[model samples]
Target: MSQGQHWREQLHEAAAQGDTASLLKVIRSAVAERADVGDYTLMSRLLKRIGRDEASRAGLRPVRVYIARSVTVESWLPYLAVEAAAAGFWLETKVGGYGSFAQELMSPEGALRDFNPDLVVFVTDVEDVAGGLPDACATGKPELVRAEVERGVKTMEDMLTAFRHHHRARLLVQGLCVPDPPVLGDAGDANWEASESRATQRINEQIAALCRRLGDAAFFDENRLASRFGKARWRDERMFRYCRLSIAAEFFAPYARALTHSIKVLFLPPHKVLCTDLDNTLWGGIVGEDKPSGILTGTDFPGNCYRTYQRYLKQLAARGILLAVVSKNNEKDVREAFRVRAQDLALTLDDFISLKISWQDKAVSLRELAQELSLGLDSFVLIDDDSVECEAVRQQVPGVLVIQAPREEPWRLTECVMASGAFDTLSVTAEDRARSDEYRAQAQRAQLENRAASREEFLASLQIVCRFISALEAPLSRTVQLINKTNQFNLTTRRYGTSEVESFAADPGGLALALRARDRFGDAGVIGIALCRTQDGTCTIDTLLLSCRVIGRGIESALLWYIARWAASLGANRLAGEYIPTAKNQPCADFYPRHGFRPAREAGGKQSRICYVLDLATQMPEKPAWIQTEEDLNNEPGPSCARVNEEFAR
Candidate 1:
């Protein structure tokens, strides 16, 4: 029997025997396997019936997804759930009534609002926009096309506004795809007015712009997705005739794969660092054997593809994914290779945050890189051309996602890495664009620290600056991102949706603070969020989270000091804090105690949750003198960077 057949039989047997352990193992193996759509459908149904809750218990982040669609997506729901499961999310999906999304979104007693999804997906079918086109409207007329565009965008704006009126769930709006045939057929490719494809593409662009204005919304390019999967194959006339299915049954799995790629970002942050192999993975040949002169990485046949691959990596670096080298090669030789080929190279040696070029196991090198960067093993994604090396790293350091780059077929390497979805994110902020530079500065700071005589001297020499922005003044995107992503050094790993974070900012009783830290090296953008509420002359810190990158720095201390002073200003007699124990939050288990708060006893003397309270008048955490702290505060400022009140900055 074939290997896949054998695996499927084993999986079936495990499920039939009701062996939970065996079933979980099989499911893990199956999710990673290249299974057919039919088999995947079966596995998904079984998982839904038996394994979803168990999987959540095992550690899958539970996400509620509501699909607001006018087409038949019920058949596609299993695919969506299965793909989400694979991407470490247990999705409970709710589909709106067929062809009734307008009513569903507008109604006061809407099911879409009732489901309370973490993400609301608007899976746009072409009929959504094109159905409004006038019967006699010529594709050659820009006015006709423009009217439809306005109508479509206006309709979407109205629905979106209504949806946001009740829900703060992040939106994933699917871009509308062109129908099977072009509107003008032979003349379709002439201009924007000449083709339905052009019209849809224009509408998609407008939709993306609208989503960008909405802040928490993302546009999934169904146009590109359909093109990639072949629109010819995705369509089924019989299925559409029987039911309102636009996407074929077989294509639902791919559709789900695409959906999950976007949805995954809503729950989990992308891999922070990319560990790359130097030799054949980055170039077209082994550097040790080929030498610097002979390395195929210039403007040539195979070399051009390798060069294209490097460009892709550079683009990813630009978008905040740190790149590192974990190759079994001589460091000098690699440096020489880049130096010799500087004119044609897309990447420089300085692009890499950590270079583990000694003859060490890639897994060991990755661990060292993790330690050096002060990041967890799970934050890495490694790509190598050797399958053996990839498998070895997978076996040894399973936390690191490993991608096997196509060895001979260099052209496919970029797409393969892109398809891995390890570095997926909905949007990139200014901080994201500066991430690589910030990490490089971090490396410089590490060097400076190694040379410092004492901790005090090191801290003093760093010249760290801590700037506080009030919840009202702070950018909600970064604040919400920090709140959801930071696990370690978090008093309570309380993840909040964007809407809740916005509500915290809007509420008068709540005091939410975001801190931006910068040392002599560079700016580490808003790295901490403290969500607090005041009641009965007491200020309770509901959530205090510091990004792992800036946790050990004195910024957290400075932030606590500001919070205490803010509370005191508000006439809060006591400052309250609580530590909720989580597997990953051991680093912050004693955070309150370290800050001079006394642990308070609960009615049942519950050991799971430890509460602390400090008299604001008597006890205040010492703000680090070495760091210069500033605050724009709660006072409204003009449309500029000018601080409204530096009085709180002392």
Candidate 2:
């Protein structure tokens, strides 16, 4: 066999034997020879054989890539990359050491320009800042390290700018992983970790700031992951494990893959709604029999935990996850708990999209809730403290994700859920932070409409403003979010990735617009999004979705009006859209007809598509004064208005 084949066989054998030293030798040898042995693809295939394809597809596989030349990089990069890749990601494997920050930053841009990639993964070692190693061993001295780190930061910023300017590639910045201070003899001495942790923290902070400024990049916390595994394990084992030959080459493979998988999942959007149980789940006891004061929420050790869990849920609600109650309890008791005793409760009934408190099977209740919220069962997560309840829902509802509550240690419930990492995302937008308040306002609007006697009167009283703007060079995070989470008001129900949205906007034929609404009750944040493309002077709506909280207020009509007007301004003669229904989007089945668009075609099943068109040149109805003009819309900073205050009061 040729030398390349010989090394490949050696690697395969080392991987099979789980020999760490042999594996490292093979990897190092491959790197030394610059042998394009396709190790990443080989490892990914092997992982897929074990039914662990999630990580492989994410591109976290073993391959050498140029990392900064420092004692920390020399010590940690190989293992970190292997673990991260095995966790999933096809890593670039070009091993060359950089002596300075400017070199490190500029090198990648040249490499990227030569070899175009969809994503770039950058890792920095915390040791550069933490400072225990001698000056000769580290990349730069204490005083000089700041400039080096800044250069690295600027390099990333420049690279992202280039990516946006050229290929529009996505960037994932991995935080520096630190050695356990205790294990490294730096623990408890405040100063030991102070300089190091602070340095690493500063680098991460810079990285995050860059991500926000760039608008498309994401920051991943490698230190957080390393911390979770403990400093002792990272120092004593991880640092040296990948360097030893006798250890199984593939022993850390799973861990690497898991890390990559976790990062990829973090980038994926999260579920929009949470379906939770009441008794012993949200609180410590049954509300039906126990007096509001009798419930064990918000007091001692265990109660504190339950309260902490509720607070976390409230935080989640604030991030725009529609909270709904699915419980088997007395309706009056539940009502009193939130109304009278819930001043201390982390969440209230007003926060939920739907509340079903009856003896009905939870699976059935969930179905009803989905219908009410205009969401799919797949988009909902079911949380209950009872194992039987969790299992029953899982068995009955195939798509419903069931999360069991902490039965024995009720206080640990919050930690358990958080640990599951169900809600982690690459970034959170301003719209997300105000989600709970928006839902609360939505509930009040519903109540008012029910009593108003006429839809027109209720809408008129709303004094709602619907603003539309042509897509700019702004971030697509909010647009991507609405596409993923919205159901009831989603006309086409098509979800797009960040990259896809960017591509759509760049296309001359395509169109993207954001819709914001506010009323006397409160500002609803950015509640609606629509993306379309023009063909033969006809504008076709590729995506149309709005948050449920802002529905029933004539905002939909206002939005359509804006689209029609925009199409006319663009000199398009016709406006086209589709109605593809999901289980939760039945509410919008008749939406097009109501908006003066007629179906030109139809198909079958959930996959069925419908096409509609309207002549933009034809005079449309007078734009509602309540709808804010596009220019006026840009003046408002965020969703802050009396509408939110009124909703909170209600």
Per TM-score, the best of the predicted structures is 1
Give the deviation of candidate 1 from the true structure as CA RMSD.
3.2
Poorest lDDT segment (10 consecutive residues) of candidate 2 = 635-644
Model 2 per-residue lDDT tens digits across residues 1-650: 77667767877887788554455445544533444325544533443333323333332333223433333333333444544432223355343343353344444356544545445455545443334422311433456546555654655567546554554445556666644453324443235433445555676788788776665467776677556655445444543445422112332332343345445543445666787888898888888778777777765766677778888887887677778888988898888888776766777776677788999999999888766554567667878998888879977986676778877778777776665455667667887676656666766877997899777777777777665654342236677667766767888877555667766666766667677777777876677877877667888888887887666656777777666655555557888878886667877888888777767755454566777776656646345544544432232223322322332354
TM-score of each: 0.92, 0.68
Please list all clashing residue pairs in model 1, or write none if there are none: 139-193
Measured over all alpha carbons after superposition, the RMSD of each candidate to the real structure, in angstroms, is: 3.2, 10.5
- lDDT per residue for candidate 1 within 143-255, as digits (tens), equals 77777777777888888777777677888988887666665654554544436666667778888888877767888888787778887877787887788788887678778
Report clashes for each candidate as comma-separated counts.
Answer: 1, 35
In terms of lDDT, model 2 sits at: 0.61
